[model samples]
Target: MDLSRPRCRLWRELVLVASLLACGIRQASSQIYITPDSLIGVERYSSSLAIENAPEDVQEYSWHRGANDTEENLIISYNATSHSRRDGPMYSGRESVSIRGTLRIWRSQLNDTGNYTVRVDTINDTQRATGWLEILELEIPQISVNTTSVVDGEDAVAATCYTNDSHVQWYVNHAPVSSNYRMTISPDNKTLIIRMFSRFDSPLQCGIEILPELIQKSDLVYVTVAYGPYSLQLRSSPTDFSGILSAEIGSQVEMECISYSRPESKYRWIHNGSLLSFSEKNITLPSLTWDQMGRYRCIAENSATQLTLYDEVHIQALWRRPVVSRSFTISGSLLVFLIIFTVLGFTHFLMVLIRALFRHYSTRANWSI
Candidate 1:
């Protein structure tokens, strides 16, 4: 072997050894830290935590309630390097050496509320972290009205209240209503239902109160009571048909009569004091003959209230017969006679001319002879 070749191989081996040492040192120096070792909003609940840089084989992990390690609450003993799991009632992850595990607490119940801690152990060193869990029980109850408005005479309207806590009460118009018979509280005590048989036309108030804590009120809803009599009024196109007359017999006539009351109005046609059979919004007679000609009247009435209104129409019959007098007839006859006389006179003159011509012809012949 050549010396330079051996030297180069030795240098390469040294370089490789140095690189390995650097990587080993870096790995050894890298340590896991849990950010925010403590947390709130954990609200008496168990939460998850993230463990970072934990030894690849973390055999045992411990959890406790207090800062002193003496009182230990061993939650889990697992073998994993970088792992995450729910530690407390609240699901917040922890990665610092502080609290690397979740702490469980009952958020609604005030009992299981306190400081929580978690410790991670890797054969050589142990890391610890802590967090606190709080409890809140105040919650607003939900209130709802069945209907925004109720018709008059309608009764037993239901209003409902919902909440997280079981203790709930019902109220109407700011007064506490008994939750015994008319009002009912759900078994969970979270929902309160109230029913009232109300006749007042004014708006009624309803609300729900979570026992000793939260109260929610519903907006007022009105009830309408309707009572009225049907009334009729004749609404003619020309409200005043005072001077209208002599309408063509065959023309379409319109007479409008509308009921100004809740129910619709009924109408009947009357002509010359006789009640006609057909009735409608607009009365139309196809062809108004002489028999059907007379003073027409429209009677609009509300059957319920017996209220009636009348609209009269005067229709003049169309006289289509020829109206000529005796004098006119005689004059026409005389004119015809005069024309005949003139024609006869012209014929007679022509005949005379023919006869004269014939006589002249005969005389000329005699003279020639």
Candidate 2:
């Protein structure tokens, strides 16, 4: 307590300065140097923090997961002298360290993504390094169209490129797609909407672009256009356009129906005013007779467009009436003799009648001439 002892005061200051130097050295060595690059976790698994520095000077190794090193975030510690390791409660049986000081976490999920740091104590120095674990979204993506098929008109249709957490782009005919007034795409470039479609615009090729420079093409779904059966015509066996087909008695006549349609028209034959059982493009009448001479109609109908057309033809037989079947067995000579005798008898009767009239006239005296 006396001020006379100046040497004692100086000695006290020296001791305090030595203690400060030791503390400065310790603080400088404790400063950790972390790698600027961050680690990336891909898919459903992740990696853990492991001090890869295998220098013989490395006496101790430690790992932590926090902004600043603290007792709570201490994950694992290894002592080189004792050849022993201790794991904190956070990584109890799941965290492991290799003899070369590599930390690994097996079977990691999407949520196991964050910062990690390692503290190393070497023979010459003690320092720390920090890095990060980032899990990249690896969910598979999809591309879909709203309508499987459509009619060519002002109808609306849509397509979409889909993914869970990634951005995607759409392609048309192997090229990148663009949006316009009549056609629009969503802001995320996933949904494509079309207002109207043209006849030539059918079979639009749509696709999707995804990771690994891969492209997925779409199935062929062309828009359907509806039309009709046109240019309907009817032809007979002779293949002429006389409107009348001549057939010998008891002969066969074939008729063909010709037309064009989108989905092909079905043929139906009409005999007279009633429908026939035939439904082929061409028909045949097995036998032709005077009674069968009439008008035959060919009706062409499209099942898809519901368009129908009709044409008819008249059949004429060469014989006016069916040939009569005869059953006579008489000779020519007998037939001539009968004919002459009949004529002679008729002549004799006429002569007798005339003579009687003349005699009557003479009896009356006024007939003297």
Candidate 3:
């Protein structure tokens, strides 16, 4: 649908009169013509219809609300000499005739829309003119928002008041609101512009005045407001410097990451480019070891606004207490002790060998002879 086009409709149509002259059908140009050949009337409003360009010495005029067959419904009649006017019984009070051969209808309704004709009688000739009237039916107005949901930083949003007529008003949470510096309304009072609005604002409505005693307001519509995720920060409870952490073996590790967003936000932690086992806002590693060292990224997402914030972190395990180094030094000491002991034993053996040889040679000469 094209929103810029006018919704109101006023239809006009030509209504030809039936043959009334005794001589047969006559040309339309020879008949008396109404000032406005066709017209449209609004419900409950008064409008007029008149005869014009009639020949001189016109004696009388009679008006009918339908085709020639419906002449009994003579709504109005005028006599030039007596300067008097009369109306039919059906139009006793709602319709009247003017002194100058015109018809006045008050409080027009939908049923009043139809073809009408007027017969003019003069001393020289008789003529007839035909016209039509279309009465418009009023309807209830409606209100619509361009979008049901919007981001906070949007430049503008439109709240439209939809109706056939130009008269309209707006409301917020049942309270009357008008165009201002922050809000603007179109010239036809059909569209309202809003510069900004938060989720805390109230619902909107559109209204119209059907009559002096009745005011019609449309159903309320609530809008949603979305914000962003900002200020992303991630850190461990024990503390680390620029994504570096020092934790001894068999020690528990705890880290907390957060970001700001409206309607809260969802958090995710990634370790070494993979999703961390922990689903909560915090990431924890049990008994920190060298294997835990890697890049840690915390992602914060705002679902409503579809915005995200991320921060990467690196952690390293710092060795505390040189227990293993001291144990390795003791093994080196044992090796040195074993080498010295082996050298001392070898020296003792050489000495024992020399002593044994000396004793055997000294005792062997007398015993063997």
TM-score of each: 0.30, 0.38, 0.39
The window of 10 residues in a row where model 3 has the poorest summed lDDT is 13-22
Off by more than 4 A, model 2:
1-202, 208-216, 222-227, 260-264, 318-369
Residue pair clashes in candidate 2: 32-128, 34-130, 50-103
lDDT of each: 0.47, 0.62, 0.70
Candidate 1 on 46-84: residue-level lDDT in tens? 333333465654645655555533333434333345444
Q: Per-residue lDDT tens digits of candidate 2, residues 1-369? A: 011211211110111110000011112333543322244443334354434334567787777776545668878878877889988755645566666666665555566567777777788887676666555444445556677454445467787655543345555444555787777878876677878753444554554332223333455445565445789989888554568777787888888998866567888888888888988988877887777788999999977566789999988765476688788777999989988888998888889999999888778867564
The best candidate by lDDT is 3
lDDT against true structure, model 1 = 0.47
For candidate 2, which ten residues in a row score worst on lDDT? 14-23
Model 3: which residue pairs collide? 243-314
Select the stronger candidate by lDDT from 2 and 3: 3
Off by over 4 Å in 3: 1-142, 162-182, 195-202, 205-220, 239-245, 262-266, 273-279, 302-304, 318-369
Top-TM-score candidate index = 3
Candidate 3 residue 166 Cα shift, in angstroms, is 7.6
